[model samples]
Every structure is written in structure tokens, then in C-alpha cells.
Target: MTITDAPPGTRPARRRTIGTVLLWLLLLPGLCWTVIRLGGWEGHSPLVPLLAFTPYVAVGAWVPALIGLLTRRRLPGVVALLTAVALAACVLPRALPDLDKGLSRGVALHVMTSNMLFGGADAATIVTLVRENDVAVLAVQEFSPGAERSLAEAGLGDLLPYSQLSPEWGATGSGLYSRYPLTGTGTRINQGGFHQAYGVIQPDGAAPVLVESAHPLAPAGLDLLAGWAGDMAAEPRADPAGTARILLGDFNSTLDLAPLRTLIASGYRDAADTVGRGLVGTWGPYDGDPIPPVTIDHVLADTRIGVQDVTVHNVPRSDHRAVIAGLILPMAS
Candidate 1:
């Protein structure tokens, strides 16, 4: 065969080589995620906070694969597609849902959680939300001392007769208020060194529910990462189903963080995720903040409890939106 009739394998071979290189490069994030899932990075990694929104990353990975697939590049396209699938697999279970939309068959208890932004939230708005929603229990983070007066003046005390207040100077305060009687209540300091209050609230005629207001240090830098991890690590590893526990507040971490995942793995589930509202943003929308919205606030509960409804609401003056859930507690056996 003359040179002109030579086999045409060279061009195809070169194309395959280029495709292989592209495939490997495109899959690097997949490798990083594998390390992250295995290493269990504490709240220290900036990537840690971003991990909470893995659905976005997963979607981003699929675009290149789609392009290659349309162009008939088999190997590169298959590899990219596989990588995209892996990325989605890591996050979709939480983002997507198979939640039971059926109404709860148990006793109803409305709970609400909000970070009052160092006492800057509108007292009337807070009180109105509580009264209007028929909130049985409320947890507030950043409960500045000024909040005590504002809340009291706004009729919060009358609306929710029982409370455990740990009023601090600035963003170092936390409190729990309820219509139910709170017993075995106590004071504790959270990861950010803020005072926190927790206790058992027994509804008028229902079984007692263990409620806690949690606020871990925000995962801002490496210096605070250890503390953030420790903060989440210190929580009791009890099954919510066995005792009926409700843990809600500004966790300062998201579902993507390893520490937060660890906390949730211990038998509690975010109320928002329970009904597939996990992707909704709970922070931002304040006029001056540079950070975009994110779902940093949460309401976590035991497995045995039935979630009737879960929602996010605006608190007029606060930066973080409030989360409210209607939970069905198991009747007294």
C-alpha cells in the first residue's frame, strides 16, 4: 500500500489520547470528594462549608459530559458521565426525597428556631411569629441581653410562659421558651463559648420531648475549625426515636460538613430535609451582607417523630431566616 493508502489509525489514536487526558482532568473533583468523604475534614476546610451544597457541584460536573456525549467521544464522555454520577450520588439522597407527605397521626407540636442577630431582630415580629404559628417551643440563638427586654415588652413571656434564658452581652446568648412546662433544664456553653439553655418540655397531655438550642462556632477559619468539630462532637449520641429529642438552631455548619453529618447520623434528621426542603436558603437577604444565601439554620429531630410541616420565614431585622416545624410526638405509652 502506498503512503496515501496507509491506514488512518494515527488521527484516531491521537484523539483517544486527548480524550483520555480530558477525562482524567475532569474527574479530579471526584477524587477530591472521595478524599473528603474519607478524611472527614472538620469544619476547618473552606471546602467543608461549600460541601453542604454539593448538588450544585454535581450539576456543574455534568455539563462537560453532556457536551462530549453529544460530540460522540465515547471514552471521555463515559468517564465524565461516571464522575458526574458519582458526584450526584454523594448529594442527591439528601437533596432529593422520598418523604411521606401523609399527615401525621401523632400529637402535634409546633417548634421554631431563629438566630436573633445579636438581639437586632424585631421583637414584635418574633412575638407575632410565635403567636401566629402557635409555636409550642422556641429556640433563639444570639440572645443578647437587650433581647430580654424587647421580648418581654413584645409579650413573648406571656405568649410562651416558660423559658430558659442565657442572656449574654452580644452574640453569645441562647434561650429556649415554650408553652409547655420545662423541667430538668440547665445551662451550658456552646462551641462559640456562648451560653445555651436546654431542658425537657412535657406538653399538657403528651409525652415529654427533649429540646435543645444549639449554636456551634461558625467554620470561618482553621483556628476555629477544631473548636467547631469539638462543638459538634460533644453532643450526646442518643437516638431521637428512643427518647424523642429536638435539636434546632444555627449550627454554624451545614449538612455537607463532616461534623454536622456525624451529628445527624446519630439518629437525628434535619426537619427541612425530612420533607425535602433541605436546599432552601436560610441565611442572607440582609441588605448589606456580602455572603449569598445558604441553608445554614436547621431543625433536627428524632426518627420516631412525625413531621407535619417544615418552613422558613423572614425575621424582619435578623440576617438569618427562621425555621419552623410542626412535629408529631409519640403519645405516652
Candidate 2:
């Protein structure tokens, strides 16, 4: 009884030690990573990747703690469970876009659009990453003369098989590249006099997808962006089947902006939002200062297409990082 009774005090201290270690292991890395992400310094920005999916990290950290609680580990378990529920409640509503179940079937396509900063070396990096991801379609905003040639040489031309480049916004509009047969090659959506290219993209064995590649007019002047975004969101849905629609481009407005509200209201769910990667800032990697990043580049989808994953890739040469989304048709029979 002497040794056994005395041992009980040490057992609690040991359990506390183990609990503390688990908390640091499970929570510290993600929390520190979050801090670094939020603490941006110019081109050292990590907001794009963080915003695309940081909430999940917060949710993940609670798993170990929740395990501890269920196992009667006391304080750590309470901390973990509380944190997880709080994060889910805060993130799930705002981050997850309301999407239709039909989006989960049929065709699978991954598309990306980025403003390649015209003369930056990131153009090559963007093209390389896009090909590596095996994206079915590539929509490039700010496609300059020289950068376009570089992307072609980087094998975007050969791998994609079909391509369309717009001439109006030279070095700063939209272009489409596809591995499948592309048709309906014509001007479809125009915003604030900026003509972006749009067309029908037919991936192998899938129905034709309506691609609206745009580089909407930037919100630079006096309240012009509101009207510009309004026009973009109000564009009539012209596709016959409403088969699958992808509105990808550099919209120049954050999701919080009033102008973007119309786009969301018009049955267009942001891919990043649908996936619940909140508050990803895409436009501040090159400018050397700290600024809370905002989601400026977007991939908006109609309910007919399912979003598999939405991510922001790190390409250092450009001012804006790239946004990519993988799509699969949920109802494809």
C-alpha cells in the first residue's frame, strides 16, 4: 500500500506532461503557420495557400485533443473539443459555398487562371505547374505578347492541343488552352470594354463545357468597379444544357466587396468558398509590405459541376498567385 499509494501523484503529473506534448504537437505547428501566414511581408506572402484551406488545419488540431477528452484526459481534451467546434462553426458557414449535388458527376476537369504579371518569370512557373497538375483547361489573365510565347514554348501549346488568345487587352486579358477539342470560339463575356475570350471546350468523352475566361476591369477609378462587377454577374446564362460552366479570371474584387455579391447571388458559387478555404489573399506576393490578403482571383461554378478541390499555387514570379480548381460532374451516368 505504501509504494502503490504514493505512486498516484506521479501518475497525474506524467499524464499532464503527455497532454502538454500532444497539444504542442497537434496545435502549435498549425497555429504558428497561421501566424506566419497572417504576418505577410511583401512577396513573402503565404496568404494564398493559407486562405485556400487553413480552417481545416484548425479543425485537424482538435482531433488529438478530442481523443484525449474522450479517453478522460481532462483539460487537453476539453481544449481540443472546444477549439474544433468553434472553428467549424466559424468557418463552415462562410467558407462552404452552397452548391448543388449535381456537381459531383460526369466530366472531370481542372482549370486555372492567373494574372502572370506580364514580364515576370512566374509565367513559366505557372505554365509548368498547370501542366504538372494536368489541368484540362488553362485560362490566363494578363497574357502579354512575350509571356504568351514563353508559355507556348513551355509546352502549354503542345500539351493543351487547342488554344485561343485575345488581342484587345494585349498583355492583360484572358486566353484559353485545352487538351480537348475547343469550339464555339468567339467573344462571349465583355466587362468594362475589356474583351475576354470564351468558348466551348469538349474534353475527351465529356460534354462541351462553356468556358468564360475573363479579366474584368480593375477597380481603380471612382466607384467604377461596382458597375463593372454588376455587369459581369448579370451576363445572361446562354448555354443550352447548362452542362457545366466555369467563370474563371482575375475579377479584381474581393469576395467581401459588394460587387461580387451579385455573382454569388446569381447561382455562382466560388470554388474556394465551396471547399471552405477561407480568406485566401491572392494578390500580394511581390509588393514588399504587410497587407491582409484578399481573394481577387476566382473560379466560380454553376451548380451543374462538382468541385473536387480548390487550391492556390505558389508561383513566385508574379504579383498574383494562381487559383486552380478540379471539377467533376456528380450526376454523370
Per-residue lDDT tens digits for candidate 2, residues 1-333, read 444475877877776676678765775564554444344211213232344344556568677666767667676667666656655554456566555433565778888887766545465687777778878888877666777677877777777878777743344555788887778877645546665777887666666667877666665544554545555565545343565677888777655344454565666667887776646678764555464556778887776677778888776767777888888743434
> Per-residue lDDT for 1-333 in model 1, tens only?
643465786666666667767766876675566457546753366676667656567778787678668867786678778778877766666555546633367688999998999888888988899999999899999998899889999999898999999988788899999998899998788665966689998775567778999888776777877777778788655563456788899987777677777887887767887787887888867635877677889887876677867878889889999899988887776
RMSD of each predicted structure: 4.0, 10.3
C-alpha positional error of residue 244 in candidate 1 after TM-score superposition, expressed in Å: 2.3
Which TM-score value belongs to model 1? 0.87
Regions of candidate 2 where Cα sits further than 4 Å from its true position: 1-92, 96-102, 119-121, 167-171, 188-191, 226-243, 287-289, 330-333
State the number of backbone clashes in model 2.
13
Query: For model 1, what is the alpha-carbon lDDT of residue 303?
Result: 69
| Candidate 1 global Cα RMSD | 4.0
**How many backbone clashes are present in model 1?**
0
Q: Candidate 1: global Cα-lDDT? A: 0.79
lDDT of each: 0.79, 0.65
